[model samples]
Target: MAMLNQVSSQDVETLYFNHHGWLLGWLRRKLDNSFDAADLAHDTFVRVLRKRELEALREPRAYLCAIARDLAVSHWRRQALEQAWLETLATLPEPIVPSLEQRALILETLEQIALILDALPMRVRQIFLLSQIDGLTYPQIAAQLGVSINVVQKAMVRALMQCYKVLYRGG
Candidate 1:
């Protein structure tokens, strides 16, 4: 279908000219911050450009809105995660608190892990988190979740394989 076909640079240029203002305003209303709204609007267009498929888009505004919505959700999720991390840091003694650079590195790593966890299947993710984050054994997880040990083991394997693919295999 033409909708799935590659879009040309000129088509993207036309799209930007046609809808940029509307998107910016829509983002502003959703984000309540002009700067972030502007940034996300630009990012939404960039994402669309990367997809490179818009020639047969029946509803460009709807398509843009969907992309922008996803971006906004991610933006909010990141902000919430940062706030939670900062709160955790605040609970630490000053001497034990990490340096700014170390905190940045830690936060980045945490975000990556969070993304991987988010991508995992629900049951697999629960098992993986129980084992890794809560320090539970497979048997313990199985007991807690009312599942078989074999089930827990298999879920753990799937979760680990997914993480390996995302981190090491760069999938």
Candidate 2:
């Protein structure tokens, strides 16, 4: 078992060595910063090693590249979300201003929430935004939508379930 583990480790190391540069280069083409590309490349290898069936990856290079690409897209999305959050913070009232560190924390949380919200269907997302962000009650929302209270409650529950699924998916 020890020998088998050693062989597996060696295989993963070889895979990383052979593909890290190519992955970085691929990421660099899509991203502006070499450091960011390198970071994503390292993350890709980390994810690859954690997989239970790395040996089963027939086209390892392609698989690794795909992982890196997904990471790159996620990075871009997070950055965009953070920027938007910062802008929103800047527009808040002076007494409600957040410190720099607090702003970062809030941005991170909002990004996670945004990701959860994005997974929801369009009407579900609208309902959730209206209820949570706009602070609308079920009866108020129901009246606004011309739906019954029970329908609004059901929509809220569905939206909440979708958010929970996105949050707990271990992405």
Candidate 3:
């Protein structure tokens, strides 16, 4: 068992040595950020190691690229969400605006909520945002979205369940 573990470790080292530079370069070009590319390259191997199936990866580079691409997409989505959130904050009433320290805390919480919402379907995401953030009624949401109230209700339920799961995942 110990010998097997050592061999497995050696295989991962070999894989990293062979592909890390090429993967980093590719990701750097794609992301246009050396730091993020390096982090993603590291994360790709970390995921492989976490899976404990390095030996099973026949197309290693392809596997790495796929993971890297998904991570890149996730990063971009988070960036977009942050930009939208900041724009929304900028338009808030001065009286209701949070203090600087409170704003930081709120932004962090909003980022968590964004990640929770990220897993939702596109329509579900839209409906949930409309109802929760814009204070839309079910009928209003349905009309705006061109769907029945029942469909809007179902989407709200699903979106809320996902948010619930994310919020209570540790519990």
Candidate 4:
């Protein structure tokens, strides 16, 4: 995809003039924060403009909503991940905890992991959490989810590959 700055000025202006208000209102309703809604509305347009086929769009609002919904899901995932990270931090012994800068870097890494998790299918994601977060063995996870051991192992491999790509490949 093209960068936001690469989008043509006239095209962006036209799209903003035609859809800005409606999209902002829609995001506001979904986000419940005027600032965040406004920011996401701008980002939605940025993503839309960066697409290669904007001129061919038959229904712009529908497309805009599709992009906005994705952004909303990402926003919520970050929020949930941050909350969980903070809770985990609270449980750590303060003397052994990392410094503030280290904590920030660790949180950024966790955010990437969470995004990878988001891309996974529901069953694969559940299996990953059971194995990683809940510390279950592969056989235990397979039995709990009513799948064969082979299936659980396959899901775990898929999840690990996704995480590896995000962590090492800048995906």
Candidate 5:
């Protein structure tokens, strides 16, 4: 067990030292921004270090590349969502006015919440969103959906589970 642990620790350290520059270069090629690439490279190493077992990795380079790719995709998706949200907010009426910074912050929070909601089942997502965002009480939501209060509670629990999965699993 000691030998295995030492080998794994050495392997991870060597992997990081040998490939850190290459990983940053790869990210730069994909992202076209040195600062963003650096940030992604740092995040990738953080993720690898947090994993439980590095010795079991058959292809460390491939795993790290996948992590970087996922991060890049998430960054792109967030940017797209933010742009769309800004455009939507720009057209809103004066009654719901929000400042530019507030609009950005709200969009970011909404994006995160929406990602959590996306993991939920359709009905559960709708029910939870109605309760939290629409200000509908459990009993009111139950009545509107023609379900019992118990059913509404179960749906809320299910929705919360999905949110936890997304947040904790980093999905």
Candidate 6:
């Protein structure tokens, strides 16, 4: 059992030697940026090492591809979010624009909020977005969605609870 759990440094080195080039090439084709591809390839191996599932992997390439794919998707989402934020900032007056440090902090917070919001159920997320982003009152949202005000209120409560748990309680 102990042997089943333990993968030696040599094993990791062998795995990297065997698959690194293939993984790098896969990422390069997927990302169209050699630098980002290289970074994701390294991140994939780091994830593999941290997981300590080397001995259990029946198909190393498939496992690597799955990790790399998730990383690539997250990379793309973050890039899109940053681009949107930058465009919004561009519309602001120069004097009111955030400093570089403030911008980074805001971006990070937005990413966390996006992740939280994405985890919400479809109806709940829709209600939250309508209320927050569209500035619609509960009655307005209920009318728009053809749901009762009670249902909309309940969904908002559920969504806010999810946010509270994840953001405040670290759940």
- What are the runs in model 4 whose C-alpha is more than 4 Å off? 1-8, 87-98
- Poorly placed runs, candidate 6 (over 4 Å): 1-11, 52-55
Regions of candidate 3 where Cα sits further than 4 Å from its true position: 1-7, 53-55, 80-104
Better of 2 and 5 by lDDT: 5
Give the TM-score of each candidate.
0.90, 0.71, 0.77, 0.82, 0.59, 0.84
Clash totals for all candidate models: 0, 0, 0, 0, 0, 0
Per-residue lDDT of candidate 5, residues 1-171 (tens digit): 312243355666888898899999999999999999999999998877777655556666787899999888877878888888878877989889788789778877877886787668888998998998999999999999999999999999998887777778876
* Candidate 2 local lDDT, 54-124, one digit each (tens): 44556878888788888887899899988887688789999999888898788788778877776778878
lDDT of each: 0.90, 0.82, 0.84, 0.86, 0.83, 0.90
lDDT of 1 by residue, 1-171 (tens): 554667788878988999999999999999999999999999988998787455687888998999999899888878888999999999999899999999899888887888888898899999999999999988899999999999999999999999999999986
Which 10-residue window in model 6 sums to the lowest lDDT?
Answer: 1-10
Q: In what order do the candidates fall by TM-score, top score first?
A: 1, 6, 4, 3, 2, 5
Candidate 3: pairs in clash: none
Please provide, for model 6 over 1-171, each residue's C-alpha lDDT reduced to its tens digit, 9 standing for 90 to 100: 322456667767888999999999999999999999999999988887786545566787997899999889889989999999999999999899999999999999998888888789999999999999999999999999999999999999999999999989997
**C-alpha RMSD of candidate 1:** 1.8
Models, CA RMSD each: 1.8, 5.1, 4.6, 3.9, 5.8, 3.0
Off by over 4 Å in 1: 1-3, 52-55
Candidate 2 TM-score over all chains jointly: 0.71
lDDT of 3 by residue, 1-171 (tens): 212232266777888999999999999999999998999889988876776443455687997899889888878876777788679888999897778898778767877876777789999999999999999999999999899999999999999889888888841
lDDT of 4 by residue, 1-171 (tens): 432244466877887899989999999999999998988998998886676655545677887899899999888887887798789889999797788999788888887777788889999999999999999999999899999999999999999999888778888
Deviation of model 4 at 26, angstroms: 1.2
